[model samples]
Target: MLIEAAGLCAGYGDARVLHGVDLSVGEGEIVALLGRNGMGKTTTVKALMGLLPAMAGRIHMGGTDVTALPAHRRARLGLGLVPEGRRVFPTLTVEENLRATAVPGGRWSLPDVYALFPRLAERRSNFGNQLSGGEQQMLAIGRALLTDPRVLILDEATEGLAPVIRREIWATLARLKDEGQAILLADSRLQAILALADRAVILTKGEIAWTGATAALQADAELQRRHLAV
Candidate 1:
């Protein structure tokens, strides 16, 4: 497994979120974390990235226990996250934003990112805040990829975007998956994720409701209704 979480727990001050959540993303696999809103999807990613503290359980990136490691330390272990929102550096230009968090001596480089998203290359001088919604998203994904992460995560990757942009983003994701980059994706678009993902894991409330191949997940409508519907 490229990334694994065993019996994980995390929460706000007193409102506990995840309850023994067990999830894993294998190398070169696109694993989608499916759930309705506020179902601890983003929280799980945050905990794994060390943005939030894990009160209990183990977080292993490539079989090393990184539960106690800080976010920067985890990044050094090849973990990259394109957060819930497209949290780009508003003051920095597109190129600068990619320059800031980019892990040097990594597999992917500046030219690679430019080649991946030509639109970003055109807007290289635009500050993050100046980019369009889709452009910002592209920058976010590009920034993460520049880290050359073994496991790259996206939380609500295409939320609140135009249909065209969303489609483009999904297509880009498909390309990334084809390139054998391990991806952990959380989004409201179940159908899209299911089609692209090799495996699907549904989170109900805070527990694992189902875990199976994408085909099985799609065939079982009852599973979706129970764990995913509003």
Candidate 2:
């Protein structure tokens, strides 16, 4: 597996939001982190990325135990995160944001990212705050890709976007999967996730409710209704 977290526990301050959550993303795999509002989907991803410290768990990246590593160290080990809020640097231009955390001599470069989202190329000079939500999302994905991460985790991958923009993002994710990139994403769009992800991990109240092949989850309407339905 490119990234693995077993018995993950994390949260903000004293309030724990994840309880023994386990997740893994192997090479060329696409895993969906599914759950309703206030679940630990964001916390789980944060713990894996070392943004939120794991109170009691082990995080391994490329077979190395990275439980003690910080966020930048984890990034060096090829764990990239596009955070839930599309937290791009508001003061910097689009190009600057892409270059901020970029790893040199990697498979991905500015040109490559621009090619993946040509809209970014056209708005390269715009500040992060100036772009529309979808544009900012594109920039966020591009910035993460420039890090050449072995495992990419996107929290709320398509949270509040127009249908057309969401489709574009989904297509981009599909292309990344086809090119053998490992991905873990959290999103509420069940049908889109079902079509793209190989596996699904459902979270409920900071605990893992279910983990299995996406096909199995899709076939079990009861399971979806129990954990995922609004």
Candidate 3:
């Protein structure tokens, strides 16, 4: 596995959110983390990214135990995140955002990112605050790719975007999958996830309710209703 998290338990101050959660992402695999609101999806991302300290359990990246490492250290170890809300630096230009965390000898370069997201190229000189929501999301993904990460985790990759923009993002993800990138995606769009992800992990009330191939998840309507239905 490229990323392995076992028995992960974490939360905000005095309010635990995750309870012994376990997940793994292999190379060239796309895994979807699904759940309704406040079910610990973002919390899991935070724990995995070291943004929130894990109160229990372990995290291993590229087979190295890194549960105690800081966020920057984990990023250096090849864990990249395109966080929820597309948190790009408002003061930085699109080009600068991509350049800020770029590492030498990486497979993804500015040109490659530009090619993947031509809109970014068109607005390369624009500040992050000046871009539309979809453009900012693209910039976030581009910035993460520039790190040459072993695994990419995207929280709500297509949330709050126009249908056309959402389709574009999904297509981009498909291309990345074809090129053997490992992705961990969290989104509310069940259909899109079923089409894109190899496996699915359903979180319900801070615990993994189910984990299986996408086909199995698709076939189980009752499971979806119990945990995912709004």
lDDT per prediction? Answer: 0.89, 0.90, 0.93
Model 2 global lDDT (CA atoms, 0 to 1): 0.90
Per-residue lDDT of model 3, residues 88-131, tens digit only: 99999999999998999999999999999999999999999999
Per-candidate TM vs. native? 0.97, 0.97, 0.98
The prediction achieving the highest lDDT against the true structure is 3
User: Highest TM-score, which number?
Assistant: 3
Error of 2 at 228 (Å): 0.9
Clashes of each: 0, 0, 0
Which whole-number lDDT from 0 to 100 does residue 107 have in model 1? 86
TM-score between candidate 1 and the true structure: 0.97
Mark the regions of model 3 whose C-alpha exceeds 4 Å error after superposition: none
Runs with alpha carbons beyond 4 Å of true place in candidate 2:
none
lDDT of 2 by residue, 83-148 (tens): 998999999999999999788898898999999999999999999999999999999999899899
